[model samples]
Target: MTDWQPSALQLERIAYRQRRARRSTLIAVVSSVVLLVLVAIGIGSTPGWPRVRATFFDPQRAWEALPVVAEGLWLNIRVMLICAVLIVVIGMALAILRTLRGPIFFPLRVFAAAYTDVFRGLPLLLVIFLLGFGVPALRLQGVPNAAVIWGGAALVLTYSSYVAEVFRAGIESVHPSQRAAARSLGLSYRQTLRFVVLPQAVRRVMPPLLNDFVSLQKDSGLIAVLGVIDAIRAAQLETAIDFNFTPYVVAGLLFVALTIPLTRLTDYVARRQGWYGGGGGPV
Candidate 1:
């Protein structure tokens, strides 16, 4: 094959655009950091800051709040891990069912569509409330035994719909030739999908999946509305008990501390994925 390359004009245009993008990204990131620092300094340096600091940093008060914080952290982690696993399995199946062509697929598609629309359309608070408080009246006696169950189930149900679409997109993005070649190699359709299409699709979709997981982690706070002892709820409880907002501030800081690393990791993964031809390997 002959060496082929972009024209000089095209190369120059690409270089200029790359430089512009890098400059814009750098400026935006720096501006955001500066703004955050300014706000933090303002809050910490304001009049009465000493009282607030003393109250918030009190070791006795802090020790008392630790149990609630720990409980909330456990609840948050439990909900996230359980919901994520359930959503991935259920969502992938729904996505495949939605894509498969058949009379059987019709109702599956409708169900998936309706599920996504209903959950995405409604506020998460409403869903959690309905599941936790409202569903008990119908005497749905199987799984929802308590507020936590209903709350976690609602999270899984709502996010699964969104995850299904991600899986569907990933699956469909695989080239038709890959599927055909898999079948031509004497593999069953199911076998081919399992071995070839899905793996590639998953690599392509991993970043978005991680983004959704982060959102899920944050939204896990909404469980507080359902009377679950989530981190935010624990903070609120401490606030109510002590008549101080320090607990809430402490909780906020904890969440920020936890999520900041995940956000940075997400960005790092995205950059590495790009460098590794979108496979998230080696690079």
Candidate 2:
């Protein structure tokens, strides 16, 4: 309102105010970071700190626990791989059944729906218990031990439902024009699905499928609840024996190590397939 130019001193004062504002912002940021670091250090330095430290840094204990951890890790990998293969096979069949439209297809649809509903509705732990305890109570011969039978079966049954839906969606995602084009070439429905629709749908859905596989790998730990001696269980046993937490941390790292490759592979495929562009090409 004064309509007057500032003196040199006023200009200097304005400059000083701007500099002070920047200084205050920098101080706030640095203080917040320092506070966070202090809180983290305080938490880490709590009781049993000495043993936790020794567990990771101690080479001898690490070496001693390696073999046991490796055994459990192997079991985890085996369960995941077996479940993945079974899920792919079972899921494809169910997806095909769900898409067919006819009198024969109706019963298959009902059965697939019930199967998916039952498995997906129940928690994995309950299913594992049924397999481990209930099946044995029935005295079914040729059933292997709980570890082999329950752990493996529950993983396959539970995940296959979700993956079946994934397959169904992928199969349906193929454009009707693609089907028409294939059929125009004298390809039958099954042949169109086998050669044209499924191949493209699968490539389009690879990223999600990989993500589901990773979830299956992590869920393999649920087997330990049924006494399957997976990596988590083995780590707990080792930790109790040694009275140290290092084994558990090491076991956790092993899981992270295993999953990191999968995440990277998913990213690689997503990028290669132009996932940003709606999975337009090969992954």
Candidate 3:
């Protein structure tokens, strides 16, 4: 094998691009700092700034609340992980059902479509309340009605509907010719979907899948409304003790800390797939 290096002209182009990138970075950093400083000055000049800071940004209260909120944040993370897996599985199953061919699948397609429509249209908080409180109100025999359990179920049910649509789009994006080729190779319908279509579909849909998981990470905190004792709930309890909102800010920061990395990964994947757009205003 021959090893080749860039020509002098190519090297010059690379150097030019690096210089431009560094210049852009410096401008962005300076502009961002300036904007933040201006905003801080504007806000600090307001008479209520002192009260707002004392209520929401008290460093001592944040320090005291950190351990409690962090501990509760773990529950939110666990719920997100568990619900993410379930959402993908159930979403894919619904996608397959919706995409099935032939007259026999018509009813299934109808059912899947209806399910997605209903869940997507309904408010997620309502679903959570229904499952989390209303079902437990029945007190069925041998039924465990934990708030976390029902809250997680609510997340899975609602998110699976949206994700099913994403998966369906991916499945449909596969070329019909590929399925014919798989069939000509004596592959059954299931085998064609599993081996021929699904792999490509999944690859195409990965960026959106990561975006969904990112959203799930944030929504996982909503389980706190069900009295799950997750981070938000912990913050609420803390606020009641001293009427300080710093715990809520701490909880929010923790969520942002956890989710930002996944959001960046999603952006990277979207760019890698050439799906990057909507980054600029209309020309």
Candidate 4:
């Protein structure tokens, strides 16, 4: 009876806490909105804002640029999809090469290491420039001179280097016991890798792989510099005509929109895999 009587006070306290939590959430939201508004007001009051607004935030210009920019974005989407496939394949192959054991495989291991080191160390823009410009300059017979192809190849080379390391890390992270168990079950090294080790390794590194793919999506825009006429180039053309920077903003927004979903997916995978910390954290 006494325990039942105590319940009224506890229930009231619980209700009060719930009310406070709701109020706090509302206050935080309002405060954020207020802060943003104040910042916008301050920026608007600046002397340069009128010109800046006309140039960079022009709604009419943005609307006009949308269709052309959208058309160019399709090229980017195509190139990114192609490069993503190539990167994963090349990266996985290099990773497997690096993981090979024995003196017979020494050259392969060295080559894989060198490939990753050189590409990973070089700036991606430089790689894109070299491949996009230099390849066409060579004028090799049977080689496609399309800037999109060359640019996509460059992205594959650079990103494969990075993704190779991720795959290698995943391969290495597979427990030695698991490999031993596979061997004990009469599986050959390749068979064990195919059937047991790689599957597990891939699962472990999926989040990192997704993260690299997101980066690839953004880097696809760099192809615009090669005269591929992707979103950025389209925006540039519009900007040149109208002398308004709003088209560039629109292109940027499109890229951001494309990237946000992938980034969220990466975070979701990381959380599910329990990869919550920086540098050498558990997966």
Candidate 5:
């Protein structure tokens, strides 16, 4: 078959479609802005808006709370960074263990399965509470007694289970033919997995992994319950002293800001990878 080129009419149709799409997008953006403005006006004119504004949107209070909340947010950022690395490592290891084929590896597969089931099913709050309170209560010799360590451990455990499932799904989605081909090339199972399967699996699962990271970012706030004085806790302290909720709002905004870039990055990667049919080009 000769490589067919678009005729003039076809090119014109393509240009028309592009123009229509741009117009639609512009209309949607304008309409959304209008709707938002109307909603803001409606809320601003409400009977209780003054009280609400004073409590939750006070400019001076927000300014006063910004520095403290930002400081506390730094702690959350640190925990998130540490937990993100640990969870990905632990999750990949668990997924690899679960994927092993030999009878000798049965025990490990079973353990990995049980670990994912239990951790993924449990509420994160409960895990945080148990690890934060229970571990320290034991006062084990040489174990760190710090709430930060305990909270970080809990986050790592909870998030790893979820991330493991993502990795497992990605691994399973790879064609069996690829594994067969690798083995035929004299690659051992471990070597095939290391050099072939895992790289593709990780690429396929990047978007979901990033989504889980966003969840992890928000859940990092839960560490506040352990009294690690993260952003949320800092907001709570300020609110308690001032009898206003502005600080909490500020803290929430900070968290939102932190996650926005990650979310955008996820979308960008997904598009580049042609995920959700958002085909930027060939993968």
Candidate 6:
């Protein structure tokens, strides 16, 4: 048979759709440009704009601070990567403990529940301060009293609590029928979780997991308060020299740059997993 071709009406419909899409794209681009131009004009016309620009948007200071801030950002990258792994592993373990059945597992469930509640309720900054300062003050032998160690521990503890809840939600979302089916197939509970349930649960929660990591990536900057010499601390030092806020802007931009990719990946995964609609719908 010869290749099929669209009829006149079908061809007309196809052409109309293409034209509509192009028009929509053009309108979107024009609207965005006009809005941006208006915003720039408004800001530029402000009475204090010149002074504000000199203080916060100094190109020279930004250029000079770029190398230092970027180097400091590398520390954040290393810490975040290390903490992310620990968060996932600990979170998964906590989730599993919380989900375990039977009276024998009651104490584990209680412990997991209490841990999540306590950590989730407490402010992360407070946790960081407590761990970084309080822990060091105790000064037990063989314990690392460094702020970096305790601050990183604070991050892992707080983030793992939240991440554990996410994992637990994913685990509970896996239907009981799945567990029953696994049991019928002669798989033990652990085997079922390992081979069947966790795979699907983890897949379902991949988007949320990435979202957590994105937040973790940003929060890694908080360690600067503990004097970890990360991007924020570097920016603070630069600010002290001239009180110009350019280094802060630069550091913030770097974080946004890093987080944007993970944020986009999360959206992509959400769309793929049918948790989003028509490219991206509210989830």
lDDT of 2 by residue, 1-283 (tens): 7789999999999999999999999999999999999998996889986765786656676667778987999999998898889989998888888888789779889999999899999998899888877777877688666666677898889888998888889988999999999999999988998999999989988988898998888888888877778888898888888687767777878899999899888888878777756645432
Residue 169 of candidate 3: its Cα lDDT?
A: 95
lDDT of 5 by residue, 1-283 (tens): 9999999999999999999999999999999999999999999999999999999999999999999999999999999999999999999999999998989999999999999999999999999999999998998999999998999999999999999999999999999999999999999988999999999999999998999999899999999999989999999999999799999999999999999999988888888677866344322
Cα misplacement distance, residue 231 of candidate 6 (Å):
0.4
Displacement of residue 229 (Cα, Å) in model 1 is 2.0
Which residue pairs in candidate 6 have backbone atoms (N, alpha carbon, C) closer than 3 angstroms, thus clashing?
none
Alpha carbon lDDT of residue 18, candidate 1? 100
Note the residue pairs that clash in candidate 3.
none
**Candidate 6 lDDT, tens digit per residue, 189-255?**
8999999899999999999899999999999988888888899999999999988999999999999
Better of 2 and 5 by TM-score: 5
lDDT of 3 by residue, 1-283 (tens): 8899999999999999999999999999999999999999999999999999999999999999999999999999999999999999999999999999999899999999999999999998999999999989999999888999999999999999999999999999999999999999999999999999999999999998999899899999888888889999999999999799999999999999999999888888878788867674211
Of the pair 1 and 4, which is ahead by lDDT? 4
In candidate 5, the residue pairs with backbone N, CA or C atoms under 3 Å apart (3 or more residues apart, or in different chains) clash, namely: none
**TM-score for all models, in order of appearance:** 0.77, 0.78, 0.94, 0.90, 0.91, 0.97
Which pairs in model 4 have colliding backbones?
none
- Candidate lDDT (C-alpha), each: 0.83, 0.85, 0.94, 0.92, 0.94, 0.94
**What is the C-alpha lDDT profile of model 1 across 17-121, one tens digit per residue?**
999999999999999999999999999889998897787776677677877886797788888888889989988987887777678679878887787778778
Q: After aligning candidate 4 to the native by TM-score, how far in Å is the CA of 138 from where it should be?
A: 2.0
**What stretches of model 3 exceed 4 Å from their correct place?**
1-12, 277-283
**Model 6 lDDT, residue 39, Cα:** 100
What is candidate 4's local distance difference test score?
Answer: 0.92
Better of 2 and 3 by TM-score: 3
